[model samples]
Target chain A: MKNRLRVLRAEREWSQQDLADRLGVSRQSVNAIETGKYDPSLPLAFKFADVFEMPIEEIFLRD
Target chain B: MTTGHAKRRYHLRMAVAMAIYIASLFVADWLIEDRGVTGIAAVMLASVPGLCVAAIFWILARLVIEESDEFLRLLYIRQIIIATGIALTGASVWGFLELYMLVPHIDAYWWPVIWCLGTGVGGIYNKLTMGTSGNCT
Candidate 1:
């Protein structure tokens, strides 16, 4: 999966740790998701989308 | 979840557990060496509850990591299984050698065997029953 988390966070001037804190996950996990090292589960992706106030499809798309 | 927080808590518990184990070992040694203690008295006076503390450390470490993720747990399981296989094989070989070739030496070998089994075997038991991968941390 490809996600715009980095872009979204960048736009908001938030660090990975900031997003991780909000999402209740490790910074490494956020890094993994951003770098495509790991894929987030659907529920977690939804949480991310909800946190960003964007549609899930807008934030994540298939590579 | 805070990995840092969880890691700190787990490590603290582990350190304390190790301290208790070491203290028990020291006390056992003191009793055996300085006071010439042996046999069932030594077992009752020291070894039994040392075994129990070691057992409790394994149990409590699991509780400390109860909120950890799947990847970490999987890593721990693999480490433990490998360690146990090594320890058990070593113990069996040593036991066989003593039973066939030596006298009284096998009795002396008990602590090494127990220590290996307690550390690896206990961790294995802890990681297996805890199902560590499904939690929030």
Candidate 2:
């Protein structure tokens, strides 16, 4: 899955650790997800949506 | 359920189980070999270390279950799968070699020790492939 997580995080001026803290995950996890090395589960995707205050589709995109 | 809490619990439980495992191994050896224990008494004495090893496995399982982070959990799952594969393959090959008299016989207990080492190998694998070595650090 492709995501604009990096752009979204950057837009918010949040570091990976900042996003990770908001999402209750490790910075490594944020890095993995941002780099497309790992995909988030539905619950975690929901968490991303919640944290970014955007729909999951807006944060993540079909690739 | 947080990473820090889960890791702390895992480390504490693992430390206690390992301490018990070592102590039980020595005690069991002393009783069975030095004291010349026999029959059911010897069997019971010899099982303590094995039971402690089982406890260590239980502690690891609990860490997997209690971990809330999906990525960390995935890393642990990967580590366990790699460890299991290495341990089983090593034991099976060694068993065949022993059966064919191409190698010396080893105590079956060594398989679990190999499995423990394989977990370290798995962590290294994770570090190379996943950019993180899970929570064991």
Candidate 3:
């Protein structure tokens, strides 16, 4: 599962720590999400979409 | 920012618990050196520190409980299962070695057993599985 988290975060000038802080999770988690190492849960995925102000489809996609 | 039980507080408690466990272990050996298990004080000495360390994990368990996210819970559960499984397997292997090749019974020494098991769980297993398909929170 790939995600545009890194791209979105970069657009917002947010580091992995910044995104993790906003989402109340560890930076490792954010890194995992960004690198496609871990897939986010539905709720967390939605939250990420909400945080990025983009639709979930736009942020996340199957590879 | 660390969540749940504040990393600093968790580390402090863990350190205190470990310190108490080691100190109590020495005390238990000293007090029981002559009297052996018959001395009730030895039991108390050993038990106090064991409970302290158990309490530390208990607190950590509570922190784990506080997380509503299933992803986080699964991470913890996976770790615990690995830890417990490794511990049991190592203990069984030690028993086998003792019974078959060396002594007739397993030695009472626990620290070395725990250290080896801990190394397996913390180092080997962790390296093998980088957190079981963790879903990001």
Task: Give the worst 10-residue stretch by lDDT in candidate 2 chain B.
Answer: B128-137
Candidate 3: count of backbone clashes, pairs at least 3 residues apart or interchain: 0
Estimate every model's Cα lDDT from 0 to 1: 0.64, 0.89, 0.65
The alpha-carbon RMSD values of the candidates against the true structure, listed in the order shown, are 7.1, 1.3, 4.5
Give the per-residue lDDT digits (tens) of candidate 2, residues B4-78: 899999999988888988898898888888989899998988888898887867877888899988899899888
Docking class of 2: high
Residue A39 error for model 3, in Å? 1.4
Taking the true A–B contacts (Cα pairs closer than 8 Å), what share appears in each candidate? 0.22, 0.67, 0.11
Model 1: DockQ against the native?
A: 0.20
Clashes in each model (backbone N, CA, C under 3 Å)? 2, 0, 0
Best by DockQ: 2
Q: Order the candidates by DockQ, highest first — what do you get?
A: 2, 3, 1
lDDT of 3 at A1: 86
After superposition of all CA atoms, the RMSD between model 2 and the true structure is 1.3
Where does model 2 exceed 4 Å of error? B135-137
lDDT of 3 by residue, B12-63 (tens): 6667777887887777777777447655656677677668756655655654
Model 2 compared with the native: what TM-score?
Answer: 0.95
Candidate 3 Cα errors over 4 Å, as ranges: B1-4, B34-39, B66-77, B101-137
